[model samples]
Target: MIIMKAKIILILGIILSTALSSCVSIMTRTETDVHTISERDTIFSYEQKNAPGNQDMGIVYPSSRTFKSERRLYQRDSIVERKYPDFIRLGVFESVGLIGTVSGESSYGTGMFGIFPDFINLKSDYSGDSGKLFSGGIYRIGVGEWRLRWFRDAANWTIGTSMIEFLIPSAKKQNTLSSIFPLYIRKRYYLREEIPYIALVPSLGIGWYPSQYVNLSGSIDIGSLGGLNLRAYAGFAAGLNSQEAYQVRMSNESDKSHTSVFPYFGLGISFLDFVNIVPETYKEWKDHEHSSWNIGLIQASLIAAGADSSAVAQNSETKLFTGFIFKIANASVALPILNNQLYLGTSLANFVVLGFGEWGIGILPFRVGYWQTIIADELSTEPFIEYNYYPSNFLHIGNRVNLRISDFLNLGLVMGFASGETSMGIGSDITSQYGAPISFSRAYFGISVGVSDRIFFPDELRYNR
Candidate 1:
């Protein structure tokens, strides 16, 4: 046992040392074109003309040592508006929120449902004691209305078509594809200027075909307008003649066409700025320095935790997990002490242990954290259904030291701490009267890669010019 413990300590020390020592330099060398101008080409110059009487009056001048000759270059600032291709207008949105089956058939499974997206499971078993309230997350892809140019200067209304909408619900055994090819209209009220930092948006969607549904919601968006932003919303959704509703009706042998009404409230991220329709006059000088709104769009990590020698010897093994952090929006903050910024987003993680795997979503407070050039720290709270155990809430605290490879990519070393509950028995058997439970605290270490904005380096504002 002593030798085994020593090995574990040594291994951990080596991992930490390697991670800390792998920092990458953020400096880049660039070539500049030098222009030579002759004295005759000088745009403007002046020479002192000694006045006839003053020249003989013994007027004195400063020593020649104080005078210096220098070459100067001046570049005029120009405003440029980015134009998008007519056919390439696209948008991606993701949201997480609480859903309640307000008015639906109690005997029928009224949870969220979807189609397409192979990862979604169709059949659902709602027999468990789960209540009417559950959590859900959605992913949407939309096209059209690029920047609402048709609205002219108003540009406050957007009419688009969603190509796909996928829904994942908690308390349900399977995932579902909600709709495809739905017409949506959104109206926004700006609280400030053209690039307003805050706006109220109300939207409606109507779906037809495979499943019929109506979604109505109102949301408040914060952060950079038209680009990456954070969204909070409350709305009502109803499925009439949806496939899942029909299944519930058929299973119950009832003539009534089942319908489900879900009232939900949640937060999400919107990446509508990808269409880049903001006018040049509304853009700030720094806006021209970056082509994208976020530092990173997507991040993935491979992690391992809970390495107990006794557990490994017993064949339980250490837990291996894969995590993904999706960027919703980010903004630079003005602070006195440190280089700081706020990140608003969500994360999804899959944990595998002893051949069993489970998925967890971190929504709500989303991901709120600070990131400097090379280091980042974040906190998240999520509900996880662990392998061989019931659903439990877990708190995660994580840190990362990033090594930037380029303006578009970064690799990082990650260390995290998780606090939750672990079952002492096998499977759901831990819930039995004879089962035992214990507190769970594990340290996870791994590596992550991000498709992000320029990180781990000084801003390359000169390159943009």
Candidate 2:
């Protein structure tokens, strides 16, 4: 009974707390962040240009350096009129023993590309009664706040910010305040059963993105009047935690979900600008040597939290957090090992977007880093009695995308959730439970900058050159 009260209060707290927290313009934008596929599992880095597992150069002609390529070609082939097939390629049958993907979109290797600005939904629509909107009447999520959004050509300044804002419905039903007191007692309070309410958020943060592969930023937010929110980001950034699609034991799963925000630091490289390996004597319309097959890289990023835990448990019967936290609950309330320490993850944006782009819709895909858990804590106590946390491991999957609107800025969106159950049954010891997996997805928005000097490998570069 004690445990039930604690958990119930905790869940309700999340519902309430988010009301204020979600009010700050937030950024689901992690164009500069990384994630763990499992619980700190499959650690890796971001490979923006080349897909997963590819070699690194500086910049390929076909991929970028438009003006530079054009200049180079003009200077080299003095007899411009003699050139027939300007930007053309020959086949494997004509080359010397084809070994690697030495060709188009790497039929041999993985074609990779990362979302320009960490794809997210930057637009939203909400219409309904303000009272109802305030109490889960009608509303929408997925709007971010950006400060100093320096685009691909926002001068040579190093500053920017991105914020996300949403609704935190207050309780609407009045049954919550119903109470019957003893005849001897005579007292009545506000009869307060806070309704789920909506919030207007405007986050402000500063960003330092000297290069496309890096962005260091921080911000502070306020809501519910007293600046109820605070946030910051630096180095490699990613969500605080991956989301899970809520799946009822005997019902369908919820595809749209709210993902936790996690700030992190990064230290890695972007193969976006690969060094060109142009042939000695190239044939424009007939030479295939100048082709861009892949842009790959090996990178690493770090994530950490300082005293990132939950508010004191409503009554303390249940634990709140292990490492990081939200207003209501903590993710993995058992990470006693890491305190303000760093977690690692690899970014396969390059491979994901690029790989999917070839198929058409530019669908990006990524594996879980720490999304999988050996065991997720299970609830044992019931509203009737008992108290315990059962733990187990589970699996998760997710993806992200980049939607470019103009040259100066762009938007981004990402979604992911967990699958399978790593439950901790109420029975004696921790047990393994098997069932259909539960998954969650998040859609946010962001603005990308500095794409002027960039080019569309091979095709675009070839013609310009």
Candidate 3:
């Protein structure tokens, strides 16, 4: 029990630290006003050339200077035109690549996925009830999207799906929140000339939670909001619900959902910049070549933990147990928000104490993070830090260096502090018969091996690019 408490505290700390530190925004937009200025200058020059009575007006046209300026402008325009094909290639291909994505949205007034029943006809229509409107009700849906762009980045079609799980009050009141499989397709159009870049998105999809419900939604994405894309969406949903869906999941609840046209509105923040990438050239697109894929494969570690042992019923000083740890998979992903050099990943590993006849596995995905590349090439090195939580009530912090052997594999040497209850069963001669709670801390070393990049799509085989 003591070790379990420690594990909870450690997990909470990790959550708080990540949430606080990850808010720093690093995106800076580049200026594209050069083309606008060039257009205005060209128009002004044409007007001057066509001015009335210019022949008699003795307008001393500096022919040599004018010719040079015109030549330079023409060359600049030609260069820009030459890059248009590259820009088209980039927009059509970049989003098609599998890349890290994170987004969130909330709908108010309308419930996209039955967030709140529009009219609860339980005791009668409660649609106008102010209490229901401000009940702190929420339905959160998150999805990872696979998007395809076409026609010179002018349009994109996205297909995405996400599992539905309730949180907070929703979970406590509902006995079962199951079969929530949401699939959606959204279309986006970039408005390039807008001062504050904007995207018009119209989406349609279905939420299949035992039954099918149609969802129609639309949002306007404002590209510049403190380096984050701000999305405002409002939509309505048409679906059927059982009587159980109407009952408010609350301590003292009286509600029923009997409405099909549930209206919703919410705001979201995304790492996706649908508008800005529309103007990117092929060379600029190469920077994102490595962004989509992640390091894949499992990492196994031969570990030892300190614990009391005895050949008979007598106790002995602490010593290391020849245990083994095996994680199913390990992968490094580019952090989508920062879109910088930093990367984050996770490992799912299990541990077995051979001497104690005890075993433990990670309860959640163990974080394997910190991949700021200090060096790149055939011989690559990056800093690595890992935080792991075990079902046996063990919490570990592993700090190490990662060396990339090739494009598909990496190796690391790790040494970190481990603290928690010993997973020693009572049957073991060393452990107490009652399975007394055992606690210990030790510094341990482990080696990590895994695949480097798990490609999602070919770099070149994207839409006719």
Candidate 4:
């Protein structure tokens, strides 16, 4: 009853959240392009006089726009109309991003810690033995997780740690143990207008829980198959315990011990940047270098040209972005070849590219495909197809019914197939993680959050003329 009630509550919460999401708009206002203006002399003169020099501070400009233009290279203080739409949107993601940063950095140092004794007991129902045996040992498995992520520009660097315990059942007794991961690091780079991003992780460290041992591990996350994150970690460990605590000696059996090569897997919100992490130093510098006069120049020029500043701000153009999506996801992988055992996985989709015409490749190192909207209106249907290869090889094809919950979020149901096998999942393919094909599984349900000025413009903003 409790579980059912909890599930009901969860469903209700999702409904409420989705309803609220529909009301939230991803407001966007384009930066005024002087090139669009018939008169360029005013802008040129302002640039000439206010350009920064080695000795002259001149007039200041918003540093946020420093990298806003590719053509304005080498011009850090380029002044243009402050894009009002960009800042008009409520700082929704900024707050969430800050929360992630804080939780990630402090989890390792302030989380739970303890030491306990472990016991192994044999079951009495064994057919091979009528007697029960028991053994005891001391062990420590730090149960906690921490991830510190840096999301700036189009790059992300995430460092994290997780402690997981494993249980081994033998003929005589059952033993419990856990692995201590001191460090895990990943670097992600985004490709504009593409869906496949790139990610790399390197590992180096030593662990001393079970015994004095050196550890080395690494893996790449492939993020194309949908709203799941997947990764593999393998390394060699010296002085590790043998798989079998006791083995009977046979005529052909040798007493030699083999080095341990361990493979670890993880699934969950792998690696993503819900919001950009603005550095304090950069923020301070930008704040100190503010130039109110440039803003005045822009407003005066517009007014002189018979334009209203408020109108210019409100009439800003909309920007369409086509770029590679970088994402982190919650996911899992089944190691069928190993032991048919399921392992949790953390993944980074480094190169999920979304280009013009809504084309891209993603779901990681295993899949490549295309997505298209069949119908777009008050309601929309998008169908996507991709080829997947990994634990299983197959083709995935599916579609989604998307209803605007708000400008920044979507609620939908997505279902599809792989070759003859079937797989289903729900999510919008906007962020690098959620808006891809669901691979390796058969079914899923999801929600997607993103940025948009509004889902449906107010009647005043829509002009039939």
Q: Determine which window of 10 residues in candidate 3 has minimal summed lDDT.
A: 90-99
Give the TM-scores of the predictions, in the order they appear: 0.50, 0.16, 0.38, 0.28
Best by TM-score: 1
CA lDDT, candidate 3, residue 439: 59
Predict model 1's lDDT versus the native. Answer: 0.43
Name the better of 2 and 4 by TM-score.
Answer: 4
lDDT of 4 at 268: 21
lDDT of 3: 0.40
Give the alpha carbon lDDT tens digit for every residue of 247-359 in model 1. 43444434444454566776665543333234432444344433221343345566655343222233343335432222222222222233323333332222212111222
C-alpha RMSD for every candidate? 14.6, 31.2, 20.0, 24.4
TM-score of 1: 0.50
Tell me, by lDDT, which candidate is best: 1
Candidate 2 per-residue lDDT over residues 76-191, each given as its tens digit: 22222222221101100000001121122211111111112111111111111221111211011111122222355332122211221111111211100111110111011111
Better of 2 and 3 by lDDT: 3
**lDDT of each candidate versus the true structure:** 0.43, 0.19, 0.40, 0.28
Task: Extract clashing residue pairs from model 1.
Answer: 114-176, 114-177, 114-178, 115-177, 226-273, 295-452, 295-453, 296-452
* lDDT, residue 139, model 3: 36
lDDT of 3 by residue, 1-465 (tens): 545654794575445334323322211223233343343234323323344553444775543222223333422432222222121110100101000111121111222222223322222222222323222122333233444565564456655554442211111232222235467677767765342467787988776664346767787866532122456666655654444563333313425533234455554433212233333323343343333224343444555544344211224354443444555334444444443334565543344332333333442344544444445442333454444443356665665556666545566665666556645222222233223335545555656564322322223212113
